[model samples]
Target: MDELDAWFPYETYRPYQREMLELAATCARNGGIAMIDAPTGSGKSSIVSALLAERAGKKVIVAVRTISQLTTFIRELELVRSRKRTLAYSYLIGKRSLCPLSGGGDVYRRCEGVKAVSTSLMRERAGTGQLVPSRDPVIIRQMKKLDTQHPIICPYFIKSRVFTGGDGNALRMLPSTTLRNRADRITRERVLPHELREMGAGICPYEMLLLAAQKSDVVVVNYHHLFDDEIRTQLYGSLGIEPHEVHLLIDEAHNCGEVMQGVMNTAISGPALLQAEREILGLRRQLKQAVAVTQIIRNIGDFMEGLRNSHEAEDWFDPSIFDRIVVRGSLYRDLSEVVDDLMQISEHIREKNRAAGEYATTAVEVLTAFMVRLTCSAPDPAFLTVFRRDGDEIVLEVRNIDPSGRLQELARSHHCCILISGTLSPIESFRRYYFGELDVMTKTLPNIFPPSNRMVLCAGDITTAFSMRQNRENTDRIARYITTFASLAGNLAVYFPSYQILETYAGILEGRLSSRNLIVEPKDARDAGDLLKTFLSLPARGSSGILFAVCGGKWSEGLDYRGDLLAGAMVVGLPLAPFNRVRQMTIDYYRHKFGSDGEFISYTLPALNRAEQAIGRVLRAPEDRGMLVFGEKRFLEPRVRSGLPSWIRDEMAECSIDSFAAAVKKWK
Candidate 1:
């Protein structure tokens, strides 16, 4: 606390801020791991940054969950550097975020051919942080000098040259350039942003960041950069850093566990398979080697098409049919052989496209991934190897009902693994599910925000029990209940259990509320960030807007709505599992893993976590005040209350709609 007190930006620490720093200090001294759960407003990022900055002879790597979330970390580090005088870090962007040449305009489409030629090479070698010469820089330079504008050539040339064992400048430049820095400005030394890497450093930013990691105190990255082992290995290899020398600081760590499971999960869609068959067909004219592999994928596509046709005819596809086919001993070996063959011929197929054939490469990747998943050992006693149905597509996923084995492997390799988030309740349950017997410290800070500043109201009349989901009367009642608080003078959000509920109630809301005042999140909107941005920008009377989004989606977690912009949140239903085959398998796995507490681990806890996240979106700062209403009769029931968070369960008020509305008005 004394060391951080000098550098922290706030006038005073939140009650838990000093305590969290002390815990972090203890973990550092003992060389052990710690899991700390502080609410959203408790300044987790700041304290983590402060620890990294203040600690001596050690480096911290903070893996954030999203690129959009990276800004907060960077901004916090800047604050610490202003006074702490120990901020040495870099923003490491991925190919998706860093490679400007791979995206945008017609030059981007033309760049795709070179990208395909380079993709295979990138898969082979990590850059040595040195340049070799090729036409990539010249071509990119010409493209820039042409009738069109060019993206930064440094990043493109690095991959095209370095990947194939030849080289050019390895950094990409952008039109988002600025005047050159003065000698003092460049020499002053500060954290580097991805956009300015090429212009400021005159080196390949990606390679530069890796080299910089060896000398710097911290490397800030997104979760996928570490969650995926191959990518993680490339990072370690490039830096020559061992596991014991590095400590991981994971933000939004609850999602980190899910990300680990997702990494192991692989899927194949219908269009993707059909596209692979078409891409493979094009390879037939050039080489005879394509024939055997082409036949395998063709047969696979035919089988998939047959299933879809059967479903169209009978209204439902049988899970047993897919499961039986996937498990036959001979099937696994055949799929492995095909994957090997296809991987050999994939580059040739990609080359034939001539321009941008991302679709074809993507299709090949999908098939290879699913085939690879089929070959890997299943996690443990229970898991699914079957293809599941997702509206018009059959997704073949290697679902690991158990993720602890892989997570433990990662934890054991790192010097310290700290999983921090706002909603890591029942920390023991998280440890059981995510780490098995791995030794670690766990702590939770009491809610510093008072009951007077925030309120969680439970509805006594509404219930979204599975049995009543489809009933018109229930939907109508739920719709009416939302309008009660939504009509108030505040920016509000209503979260439903699923898109079906959101859409159904949204239609009912159409009659009561104007279309102009509603922002309904789609079940699978590609860009949710944009959707939220659009919602906040609309002309409102006084920061009083209304948005309806789904629980456990882009908006339900991670997003911070602080202040008057989001003054109230209404959660419509518990995020319950339907009586489906996958659900049954999940329950069976948990029952095997946790015995009696299995149900809570598998169902009740997950639902409450989502509900808790929704309620948390409103009260984001110390002075912030908001209303949180959980509008399901199940929420107020003894069985459900027994499992909820202490702050929520203890202060919740069960009230009639009229009385609740009056109280909210009075509080405002």
Candidate 2:
């Protein structure tokens, strides 16, 4: 057996697994960045084993995009632990999932408030000679005296700790035996976030997992744990580790840009501004600049109101107009002064609310954050000021168009950074888009499964081009294509460019395909869970279902439609974002950044990535067989076709509706 097999966990390696492992090992050995586009079922999770083998005492952090992905790594590590019985690993999820407190508010803020109260009460008890507050009758009685409406005492947190030494100058706190044992079990066994919560019935699950993570050689966490600046700082501090001591593995990394942008983006809505005004009035007695800040908010609201006449659902809003309005309507000379004053005011309001046991986010805080980003955006070309109409309200956003600068910084700060995904094909484009001139290794692995197990087809007769979408002939052709694809026997999904398009196609296909159950993706997320659950269960009952969903929507990415759950997937059109002034600005920015290929990199590449994610759902494993169809003719175009994975491009058969029907019959 090879020396690295000590970390490999499995009895045997899959095809090309050793190659991807070597890529990860090289990344670890050289302390550089590597991007690997390994198709699904390539056992990409095993990359963690390579990182572990190459970790010369440095810790490995696996950042996943979803719970299922996290569980995959957890299971992989469990297998590793069976071989290396001394292996120590743990995982961290958001406190929202592990917190036992039942309430409706920002989980972080609520956690902070309760921790503050818990610490204060414990310290008070310690001063009174009751060092073991978790066991103190007096402290328990004191906790009971608190108002029931707003829970200030977090019993789990109190139970998770125990003080050591004297209560005065030599005071210290350590994890209780129960907490330590629970956390140790987490490191020894495969404990998911939910299981950790169950194990921590009396102790704090987050605290237990955090303790486990501190001693762990490997830690699994969500993207925000490392991508969001504040969260990363806090998490690293809590774990007592520096970025240089960590080797990073980002799973499903195709979504990294979007997730990083989410962390960098800031927005303030009209209702939020109105609420800020109300908050200012309520705290007018305490805020010395309350009057000025209130007027500035109204001016900002008026600025948004003025743009409501544009008749466009979304558009770019010149930041200069905002500056003019704030200066002209308020006593502030510039945005810096306005933002500084708002920051102090928002801080004061937050502190007051915390004191009152109300930890929910206030609008003043949102306004302050937005203004800070707006002021900062003046010097940052990557940031854009945009507005969109949400019913009767106008929401302003400071959107970050490029997540590379931050991602690059993060990559350079780590011991080694490895990004892996199934759809990060055209690896050179992603390398340029993500790292610019930063020297990084790129690897693209072929489909390890047999080519005959899946069939990829692209239509040559239809397009959802902007000009052609309104054409009745085009609409009729798309409906006919969808209905034809629906003729398959098992679960299938047809992804459209937008919900509007999905609804239009749904309307056209109504009462046309009655044999298959139709499941339309909801506009809101409330019902998405139930919708997906219902869709997945259909195949087991020997029923066929067709899911009409939008590309890049909830159902498109970050999901596995394994085996019979999804027999075929058809992408209706290129999922290009609707063109607007903001999009144009983004294209212009990228064009300037990437030169001739800027438009393709910034605009076309993302759309194609979405379509790839949609159609790539078929054939999750080596034995899983399914059909893949690209409904748009653009997929046949050289530029777009070249951007897709080599496996699909090589196996794809171009066909029209009649030809597709013939292929479908043969496929069955």
Candidate 3:
């Protein structure tokens, strides 16, 4: 206990940190899924750190949804290793991030399997029995030094890439265990800063990590390592790791189902189909198979024409749609073969252009992948085929209507799994949708904050319903409430259901709250950095700034607005997703299949998840006091209230502005 405590950054554990650590350790030893709901400031990372440092039973793989999270998780790993003397660990990311030299050249992308791992090389490594990598520090240092000045495009293991492509009797790096087994071997240790920088000089980061993981106790990676089939097969097979030998920890795990859905789902845009036709024309000039390629191009034009003539509407159907498309005799098989041929040729073209050192194969590769996905079989009944119309063509979206099947597979594959997040509630629906029949252990940690530090209230008179929103009287009432609330909190933010609502209400409130600056969120998420920077730079002590952002959009989640940057919120209207045809059909499908609870699962819970996320932004810490006003009357309804976080559901009440102001003043 003392040894593990030394690895923890904090002097002592937070409220639930100890319990979380114990639970995670038990999950590591046993086998099943553990569903945990701990709030934002619950020291979730600290618990995960302690688990890895102390529990050395099974190999640990920490998977998260995004790169930012992977970076953060690795930082914690660094701290644990600092205390434990040394821990071998690395982040396995997409090859593109680590390769700056693969562009504008014939230098094939690092860690490439597109060409093929030479079979002769694998047999050579096997015959020699020189499995353990032990190149000197001098050689590594020289490469790192060279890379710092001029990076090279070193596509390492051009031959080793095939060891696990389909064969299993290949090289297995000797089943190296944790630190206890490899304590004296420095070459087998974790890759440090300069070494990683050296790899960016063109070494295959994927293969490097596979060697490192052989000696590592904990390996951190993006969820793609587990969910994306191509990456999973390449990485696990190369590491010689079986599913049951590993334990998985998923942070921000609410999005686990979404990750699997992304791997399973694929979309073909209107423009890509047009481009594929053009690429076929180019192939006609290069290859003898011009006639066959020309036919596929003609079929694409016909398909586009059919979509243009049809009504512009969205429809959700089942797998039967695939059979109907097959009957049309569109070149499903030929399209697949054409993509493979084009890819092989593109490699050569890229090589020929190596001297010019430029790359333009991104679009071509993306189009080929989309075509390939269209032919995949979705045997799962939960996969829904959605068709939506665009101008000259239609976009076909394949979405997995449920995540239970994949979640069950993931659970069975690992020694055990831990799924934790701040908003993992409505446990019944989450379990039903994500875990299905698996027995999932669920736990919720109460928010650790002084009750008086935050206030939750709803406006009984003001309703942002479509019917009442534009009424002159209701507009004036809404404007009056926002202006008054703005005066109470110095630095605040307001959220809307859409950019349209943001524009509508901000204009209406401008006349009343002219002193406050209204900085709106950018329409595109990528363009939000400067807007947020300007907003965060404003004085946080007064009502001088009010950023208008749409709920569930650019500024809603993943932003840290503790203490000054955020003091209160005006979440205007329920973010009830419009009853679009697809949405209604989805609700109807669930209602017909599973009943009323299914309807709630399909519709109501998602809306509240966003609403809860919006409200949670104001109170970042125990000492930071803030206020929230729900502008929609529907928020006070029983169904909506049930979906909110327990802390809000327990304390929130309908109150007039006068009473709310007095409560905030006296709360201290």
Where in model 2 is the C-alpha error above 4 Å?
Answer: 167-169
Query: Relative to the true structure, how large is the alpha-carbon lDDT of every model?
Result: 0.67, 0.89, 0.65
Residue 381 of model 3: what lDDT? 52
Give the C-alpha miss distance for residue 326 in model 2, angstroms: 1.8
TM-score, per-candidate, Cα-based? 0.82, 0.98, 0.79
**Residue range 564-611, candidate 1, lDDT tens digits:** 778789999887755566666777788877898787777777788888
Taking all chains together, the TM-score of candidate 3 against the true structure is 0.79
Q: Which regions of candidate 1 are displaced past 4 Å? A: 1-11, 53-56, 102-214, 284-289, 309-334, 347-362, 378-382, 470-473, 524-531, 538-543
lDDT of 3 by residue, 59-160 (tens): 778887666566667667766766666666665665555543333322334224222322233435444543322232332343344332222322243312
Determine the C-alpha RMSD for candidate 1 after optimal superposition of all C-alphas. 6.0
The clash count for each model shown is 8, 0, 4
TM-score: model 2 vs. ground truth: 0.98
lDDT of 1 at 664: 68
**Model 3 / residue 184 / CA error / Å:** 12
